[model samples]
Target: MGVHLDLSLDADGHHTFQWRRSDEPGALQVAPDTLQRWTAEHEQFRAATARWQQVMAEVDEHLLGDRR
Candidate 1:
């Protein structure tokens, strides 16, 4: 009744995405565009997280310095 999306990284570092459905015997491979979009989104998320972490670290340092 439902489909699930699965992601995997191969030994050579290639990413594979599969869509599995309860009614289907085999999983469907995702399209190249889907993979590319996912990759882009992941990179964007990582960059945003890194920037946020850097900002938080700077804020913490500033607060600690203010306390001293």
Candidate 2:
């Protein structure tokens, strides 16, 4: 009766998401809206991470200029 969602890497090493119910035999494709939401969330996460990395780089430059 319960459902499970999992994230895994495919053969090409890309991230994939799958969901299944206890009574189901195989993984089910994610719904279109759910997939779209996940993609949007992932993009937001990536953008946030990139901004963080840039901030860290600037800090490093300010602290360790011409040394690193």
Candidate 3:
């Protein structure tokens, strides 16, 4: 929750973007390259998340000596 940006599609089929900072009281002022940075960060995050999921799926639950 430190700092984050979001992008979505509105009902009118247009792109909506926003950024927030938990340390600040209001919306953040975006820089010119904000979208470019978000795109790169999001791609890296997605790749890392997918790799994590794949690793978890390959793990043997019995190794932890726990059952759910």
Error of 3 at 20 (Å): 16
Clashing pairs in 3: none
Worst 10 residues of 1 by lDDT: 19-28
Strongest candidate by TM-score: 1
Task: Give lDDT tens digits, candidate 2, residues 12-66.
Answer: 5868665555445654555667766776887887699679989999998888976
TM-scores for all candidates: the values are: 0.61, 0.56, 0.44
The clash count of every prediction, one per candidate, is 0, 0, 0
> Tens digits of per-residue lDDT for model 3 on 1-68?
34465779767576656565655655455564765687688678669967987888668655565665
Model 1 bad stretches (over 4 Å): 1-28
- The CA lDDT at 31 in model 3 is 62
The Cα RMSD of model 1 versus the native structure comes to 9.3
User: In candidate 2, which residue pairs clash?
Assistant: none
